[model samples]
Target chain A: AQSVTQPDIHITVSEGASLELRCNYSYGATPYLFWYVQSPGQGLQLLLKYFSGDTLVQGIKGFEAEFKRSQSSFNLRKPSVHWSDAAEYFCAVGGAYGNKLVFGAGTILRVKS
Target chain B: EAGVAQSPRYKIIEKRQSVAFWCNPISGHATLYWYQQILGQGPKLLIQFQNNGVVDDSQLPKDRFSAERLKGVDSTLKIQPAKLEDSAVYLCASSLDGGQGQETQYFGPGTRLLVL
Candidate 1:
C-alpha cells in the first residue's frame, strides 16, 4: 500500500519569508504526488501535483513543488509567503489512474507578521 | 464551471442518530468521491464512485456508513448510529477523467458534522 508522511506537525514562519514543507512518500512503482491546502473550516484546495515530467512543478497561489525520485520526496516551496498562506498542508499519493489517494497526517502552517 | 456541490453545510446530531449528506459532482465529471476529515488530520477517503458504480469503498465503515451515486450524477452518504468519533467534515469531490495521473479534482465546501 502507498502512504505519505509529513514529518512536521507544525511550522511557523514570518510573512514574506521563504517556506518549505517536507513530504515523503512510499510506493513501489512510479507515484502520483499532490499538495493541497485547507483553511479553517474549508475544504482542501489543490496547491500542485506531480505525475510525470519536470521534477519541479508550479502550482496556483505562488507555490511550487519538486518531485525527487531519489529520496522518495516531493517538497513544496515558495519564494515568499504571505499572511494568507497560513493553512494546513497535506501531501497525497495516488495509484494508477484511479480514486485512491493516500494523504499525509498534515502540517499546520502559522504565519507571523 | 461550477465546482462540486454539497448540501447542509452544517449538521448536528446525537450519538446513535442518523444523518445523510448529499453531493452533486461537476456536470461532466465521471467520478465522485467522499472523504472524511478529522479536526487535526488530513481528509481520509471514505468512498469513490465511477459513474454510479463503486470503484472503492475499502476504507468505509460499512456497518454504520453507506453511500450511493444515482444516474452517475448525484450521490448521498448516510451514517447510522453515529458515534462521537463521527464528528468531522465530509467533503465531496469530482474529476472529469477519474484518472489519478493528471486529472484535477474540484472540491465542495464540505458538510461539517458534529455528534453529541
Candidate 2:
C-alpha cells in the first residue's frame, strides 16, 4: 500500500516571500512522485513529476520540488510567492500499481500582497 | 489540443435519487480516469480504464456506483440512490499512454455534484 502525507493544512505568505510546503510518502521500492495544484473552480493541474534522474525537479509557475529519498519527502518550494499563486497543492505517489496514485490530503496556500 | 471534457458542470440531487456524469477524454487518448474530490480533501481515484477495459477499480464502492467506458472513448459514471457523502466534484483525466505510470494526466474542470 502507498500513502502520502502533507503536514501543512493551510499556509499563508506575503507576496515576494519564500514558501515551502512539506510532503512525505510511504511506498515500497522506488516510486513515481507528482505535485498537482487546484485553483478555485478549476481542475487539478500537474505541477511536476519525478520518476528518476535529478532529485530536484522544476515545475510550472516557478515552483519546484526536491525528492529526498532519505527522508521520504518531496517538498514543494518557491523562492518568491505571487498573489496569483494561491491554491491548494497535493502530493501523489504512483508507478507500482498500474499507474494508480495515492494522494495527500492537500495544503491550501494563501498569498497576500 | 483540448483537455478532458466533462458534462453538467454542476448537478444537484436529493438523497436516494439517481445521477449520472459524463466525460470525454482527449482525442486519441487511450486511457481515462475518474476521481472523486471531496471538499477540503484530495482527489481519490475511483476507476481507471485502458481502452474501454477496466484496469483498476479497487477503491470504488460497487454497491451504489457503476461506471462504463464503452467504445474506448467516452465514459459515464452513475450513482443509484445517491448518498449525501457522494456529493463531491467528479474529475475526469486522460493520458497519452497508460502503460507507464509516469505519463502526465490532463484533467477536466470536473462536475460538481451536490446531494441534499
Q: In candidate 1, what are the lDDT values of residues B6-94, reduced to their tens digit?
A: 99999999999999999998899999999998887788999989998998899999999999998999999999989999999999999
Error of 2 at B109 (Å): 0.6
lDDT of 1 by residue, A1-113 (tens): 89999999999999999999999999998898999998886778999998888999999999999999999999999999899999999999986778578899999999999
Q: Judged by DockQ, which candidate is best? A: 2
The segments of candidate 2 whose C-alpha lies over 4 angstroms from its true place after superposition are none
Which candidate ranks first by lDDT, i.e. highest?
Answer: 2
RMSD of each: 1.0, 0.8
Q: What TM-score would candidate 2 get against the native?
A: 0.98
Model 1, global lDDT: 0.92
In model 1 chain A, the worst 10-residue window by lDDT is A93-102
> Per-residue lDDT for B2-115 in model 2, tens only?
889999999999999999999999999999999999998899999999999999999999999999999999999999989999999999999987888799888999999999
What DockQ does every candidate get? 0.67, 0.77
**Cα lDDT computed for each candidate against the true fold:** 0.92, 0.94
Positional deviation of residue B97's Cα in model 1 after best superposition, in angstroms: 2.0
